[model samples]
Target: MASSNFNRWLRPEVYPLFAATGVAVGICGMQLIRNITGNPEVRVTKENRAAGILENFAEGEKYRENPVRKFVRGKSSEIMPNINNFFSKPEL
Candidate 1:
């Protein structure tokens, strides 16, 4: 009985339909969650704003000039030579 049940589950026709239905259900569930959480509009709005030619340029420039950014930039410059050395070596 167990072997027959396993054989039925291993049938190609049955498994394909089952997998398709499962994928459809997962997609539908994701859409449902996005709708309930308002994530779709938030992502669309962020993309639209970013697509503007000069909308956030000043804000981004200010962020780059901040003190924390200066510290990170200094550290990155120091580390870059070591990183380049690692990547420039030939394989053993």
Candidate 2:
């Protein structure tokens, strides 16, 4: 049963999924490293906050958001815009 399951997951069609997952993992790892090394917020320990040494960064709000999430938020949520518009139209 384990062998059959392993073979089922080893198909050529499944290669793309593995590649995509690898790429995503690599990107996330790189981003995590970049943030850990460069982001000031990452260095902010709970003890530091309690000591009241926190400085107000003007761009703090921007730093808190992911660019992809910001972009996705601006896109329309409608699956079928035409159908929705038609249904929403008032009858004369």
Candidate 3:
């Protein structure tokens, strides 16, 4: 009777928790292996510092005038242009 109770608790269909945990652990292990061998890029150094800065600047400038940002800027200016100006100024 005690063995029957243990069998009922250990039924395979009722133990998906262990399966799910094993799947999650397997995925993490695969990702760790991929990251360890995936990247072969050379490291950045002084010679490329100016090029790196320019690349970052251009990337940022590309997003500066995006439509969503422009719309938000327009709405903010319409709603509170004076407040924007007040904040934009240098204080004495």
**The best candidate in terms of lDDT:** 2
Query: For every model shown, what is its TM-score relative to the native structure?
Result: 0.34, 0.50, 0.31
**Which parts of model 3 are misplaced by more than 4 Å?**
1-9, 41-92
- Regions of model 2 farther than 4 Å from truth: 44-52, 56-92
Model 2 lDDT per residue over 1-92, tens place = 99999999999999999999999999999999978765656665667447654574754665666687798797788998788878998577
Per-residue C-alpha lDDT of model 3 across residues 1-92, encoded as one tens digit per residue: 99999988788887798789899999999767644443222224557544542435554565455666776773654567788778988588
Per-residue lDDT of 29-80 in model 1, one digit per residue for the tens? 9768755454323334666657646545665565447565676774646447
Compared with the true structure, model 2 gives a TM-score of: 0.50
Candidate 2 residue-wise lDDT at 82 = 80
Any residue pairs clashing in model 2, and if so which?
Answer: none
Q: How much lDDT does candidate 2 score? A: 0.78
* Model 1: CA > 4 A from native: 39-92
Q: Whole-model lDDT, candidate 1?
A: 0.67
lDDT of 2 at 16: 99
Local distance difference test, per candidate? 0.67, 0.78, 0.63
lDDT at residue 87 of model 1 (Cα atoms): 82
